[model samples]
Target: MERSFTVDVFKVVAAQLIVWHHFSAYGPMSEAMTLQWPQLIEWLYRYARLAVQVFLVVGGFLAAQSVMNKPMTHPVIHIFNRYLRLVPIYIFALSLISLVVAILRTDIHADWLPSAPTFSHFLAHALLVHDLFDIEALSSGAWYVAIDFQLFVVLVVLCNRLQPYGVRVLSLGVALLCVASMWWFNRIDELDIWAIYFFAAYGLGVLAAWAKRSAFDAAVFWITVLLAVGALWIEYRTRLSLALITAVWLTIKPKSRVHWTPMKRVVHRLANSAYVLFLTHFGVIVVFSALWNIGHFHDPVTAFALTGFAWGCAVGLGLFLHEKAEIPVHHWLSHQSKLMFLRLTN
Candidate 1:
C-alpha cells in the first residue's frame, strides 16, 4: 500500500486545527487570549471544528481502499478488527482523562471540564455507544471516536451485504445512502451523533476511492458534486462544504510519488499520531486550564505562553502514546485477530 502524501498532509493539518480549536474553545487560557485576541480565538472556536469533516472524508477514503484492495474477511471479524484497532489506545486515553477530570474536579470548577464519570458512562464509552445513549462524554471530541466506529461498521456491512449483487449494485446502494444523508439526514441537527448524518461525507470518500480506481465513471464524481451542491443550495453548511471540497480534491488529486524527505517524515509521524492526539489533547488542555485557575494566570501573555506549552506537551504525549502504546497494542491485537480468523477457517 503506497502512502499518500496529500492525505498525510490533510491529516496533520486537520488534527492540528482541531487541537487549536479545542485550545480556543476550552478553559481560562482561551478566556484570557480572547481578551487580547478576540478575533483570532473567535475564528478558531467557530471554524476550526469543521476540520472534522476533512477527517470523515479521509476515513471514508481509507475504508473504501481497505474494502477494495484487501481480501475480504468475515464481516464480524472485520468489524471486530476495527474495534481492536481503535479501543486499546482509546481505553488508555479514557482512563487518563477520567483520572485528570477527577483530580481537577476537586479543586477547579469550570463548565468546560467534563463531569465526573459514572460506571454507565465508562461502559458506554468503552462500547463506543456513549453518544447514542446520550451519555455525557468524558473528554472533548470523544463523540468522534464513537461516530468513527459506527461509520466504519456501517460501511463494512453495507459493502458485505451488497457483495453478491455486483459492483454496480454495491455502488448504487452506497450512492443512494449518500444522497439520503446529504439531502435529508444531514439537515437534521439532532441526528449528528449517528453515522447517517455523516455518511454523505464518508460516502463521498468512498466514491473518490472508487473513482480513482476507475470502478465507476468519472461522471459519477461529477454527479456527487452536483448532489452536494444541491444539498448546500437547499441549506448552507460550512462543514458540508468542507467535506465536498475534500472529496473533490481526493478524487482528482495527482498521484505523484512523495519523496521521503525530512519534512515528509515529520508529516507522516504527525499523521500517524493524529488519532492519539485527538484522544489525548483534551486532557492536556484540562490540566493547563486547571493550572491557570489555581495560579491566577489571567494575563494574556502568560496565558498564551502556557497555551502554547500545552499544545507542545499534547503533541509530545500523542507521539509517545502512539509509539509506546498504540502501535504495540495494535500489532498484538492484529496477531490475535489473524489467529482467530485462521481458527474460524479451519
Candidate 2:
C-alpha cells in the first residue's frame, strides 16, 4: 500500500490536539493561564477530548485494510505483536508518571494529577488492566492505549473468523453488533474496559475502509454513513460525532502523494512519532509545571511561554524516545512475533 499522506497529517494534528488538551487541562500552569486566556484554555480542555475519536476511526480504517480480504493466519500472534509494541513504551510512561506524581504530590495539588500508585495499582498498570480494575491511571490518557488494543483484537477476530464464507457477511455481521454497541453498551461508562463500548466507532472505521476500496461496492460506504447518522439520532454523543466525521474523511481520502518536499518530511516525522508523543507527553507536563512553580514564573507572558515551551519539549522528547527506545523495542518485538508465528504455523 502507498503511504497515505492524508492519514499522516490527521495523526499529527490529532496527536497535537491531545497533547494540548493535557497541557491546558492539568496542573498549575493551566490553572494559572486559565485566568489569562479563559477561552483558549476552555477550548483546549473541552474540544480536545474529540481527538480520541480520530485515533479510533483511523485504527478501525487501518484494521480493515489489514484483515478485510485475508484470513488472520495466527490471530493470537497478531494481537501479541500489538501488545509487545505498546507495552514497553507504556511501562516507561507509567514509571515516569509514578515518579513525577510522587515528587509533585508533596506540594502540588490538583484533581487532574493522580495520587500515588499502590501495589495493586502498579500491578494493574503492568498488566494493562488499570481501567478495568478501577486503578488510577498513572499517566493521563493511558487508558486509551488499553482501549485501542482491545478494539484491535475484537476487530481481528470478527473479520478473520469464517474466512471461508466471505468479506460481506463477516463485515456486515460485525457492523450490526457494533450498531448495537453504539446504542447500548457504550452508554454505560462502567463497561469501559470492554471493546463493545467503543466498537461502534471502531466498526465505522472498518466499514469505511471496505467502502473506500476500488473493488468493493459503494453501498458499503453508504451503510457506514447511515450507521453513524443513526447513532447520533439515537443519542447526542459528541465522541460519536467526531468519530463519524473522521471515518468519513478517511473513507473519501486521496492517495498519498506529497508535492512539497519539506512539508512531507515534517508530516512524516510527526505522524511516525505520534504514538510515542502520546505516551510520553504527560511526564513533560508535570516536570514543566513543577519547574514553573519552583522558579515562581507567575507573570502572564512567562507563564504562557512556559506552557508552549513544555508542549514543544514533550513532542521533542517523544521523537527522541521513538528513535532511542520505541523503535528498538518495536523492531525486536516484531521479529520475535514473526518467529513465533512461523513456529505456530509450522
Per-candidate local distance difference test: 0.89, 0.81
What digit string (tens of lDDT, one per residue) describes model 2 on residues 1-346? 5567878888999999999998887878887888889999999999986898888888887777877666686788778877887788888878887888788775565677887778888778767788887777888868898898888888777756755577667766777777888888978988868889888788888877777554443476566578768768988899988888887887777655667689888888889899999988888888887887788777766878988899889989988988898899889878887887789879
Q: Where is model 2 more than 4 Å wrong at Cα? A: 214-217, 343-346
TM-score: model 2 vs. ground truth: 0.93
Structural RMSD, model 1:
1.3
Per model, state how many residue pairs clash: 0, 0
lDDT tens digits, residues 1-346, model 1?
5789999999999999999999998888898999999999999999998999999999998888888744344688888989998888998899999899888875568876788788988899999999887888988878999899999999888878887777666777778898899999999999999999999899998888788666463567678789889999999989999999999999789888888999999999999999999999999998888888888777999999999999999999999999999999999989988998899899
- List CA RMSD, all candidates: 1.3, 2.0
Q: Clashing pairs in model 2? A: none
